[model samples]
Target: MLRYEMQGGIWVYPGKGGWHFITLPTDVAARIKAAMAGLARPWGSLGVTAVIGKTKWTTSLFPDKTTGSLLLPVKASVRQSERLKAGDAPIVTIEIAL
Candidate 1:
């Protein structure tokens, strides 16, 4: 398992499919990529456990081709529970099981 803490701002994609996501820092993304090399699941995603504030959930990080990094989707429930909003920088703890 790989564990790390990071701070990222929530961003919303434009248009009708607006979705909130947090982009992992390049360094962290690189580390995760290297650690998960040859072990990536379908669609270049990695299963992860994420904790923000007191709320924790299981999800997957997907590679963002446009940004060349990994993006973690924050569910509506999580955003509401964590009191997070777009442009808010929240500290998150993530664990990836290898």
Candidate 2:
């Protein structure tokens, strides 16, 4: 089996749409557009805009090697309360499996 660190939360996006969680990576971004695109619900296509994150990014790892997890809900997803919050975006996060 493959081992993963969970690292932190991730944000799956669909262009102008809100961000969702396809399947957060461990210590890397989706690797490529196809990474998440392939696993998307329908499969064979992810016709959004772009995804720029992985594993709960933060200022600590910006520019060079950021945390790399772009998981966020552009609009309503933020107002879900407790689960999410609206503000200046999120970055820098860590998580591990149980």
Candidate 3:
């Protein structure tokens, strides 16, 4: 298993859905990709454990074409519990099995 701890600003995807996401830094994303080189799941997504503030949950990291990085969706419950909103920079910890 590999763990990555990073800080990023939350952003809402535009359009009808408007889901909130935290983008991993390019370097961190690259490192994760390398770590999971032979074990990536479908659509380049990886199952992970995400931690934000006092909230933690299981989610998947999806690859973003535009940024060439991975994005972790922020659930509403986590947002509420962590007092986070779109555009707020929060520290996140993610764990994944290699």
Candidate 4:
């Protein structure tokens, strides 16, 4: 298992109820690509357990071609639980298992 903790700002997608996301740092994304690229699922999504504040959930991290980073989707439930909104920067912990 590998664990990473980082802080990033949340952003909302333009349409379709506005999906929220947090982009992983470029360095961290590169590290993950090196270590876990073979473990990725379809669309380059990697399974992970994410925690923000006291809220935790299982989800997938998707690679972003535009930014060369990884994107973590922040579900509405988790956002409500963590009291987070788009534009807020929060410390998040993600655990990946092999």
> Which has the greatest lDDT?
4
Q: Write the per-residue lDDT of candidate 4 for residues 1-98, one digit (tens) a residue.
A: 88899999999988898899999999988887787868989998988999999998999999999999999999999999988999999999988887
Instruction: TM-score each candidate.
Output: 0.93, 0.23, 0.93, 0.95
Q: What TM-score does model 3 achieve against the real structure?
A: 0.93
Residue runs of model 3 more than 4 Å from their true location after superposition: none
In candidate 3, the residue pairs with backbone N, CA or C atoms under 3 Å apart (3 or more residues apart, or in different chains) clash, namely: none
Candidate 3 lDDT by residue in tens digits, 1-98: 67899999999989788799999999999998888787768898888899998898999999999999999999899999999999899999998865
Candidate 3 least-lDDT 10 residues? 32-41
lDDT of each: 0.91, 0.32, 0.91, 0.92
Which ten contiguous residues of candidate 4 have the minimum total lDDT?
A: 29-38
Pitting candidate 1 against candidate 3, the one with the higher TM-score is 3
Number of clashes found in candidate 2: 15
Sort by TM-score, best first: 4, 3, 1, 2
Error of 2 at 7 (Å): 4.6
**Number of the top candidate by TM-score?**
4
- Backbone atom clashes (below 3 Å) for every candidate: 0, 15, 0, 0
Model 2, span 1-98: residue lDDT tens: 11223333444444665444423342354543324443343322322332223323211111112334433222342324324433333332222211
Each prediction's RMSD over C-alphas, in Å, is 1.1, 10.9, 1.1, 0.9
Q: List the residue pairs that clash in candidate 1.
A: none
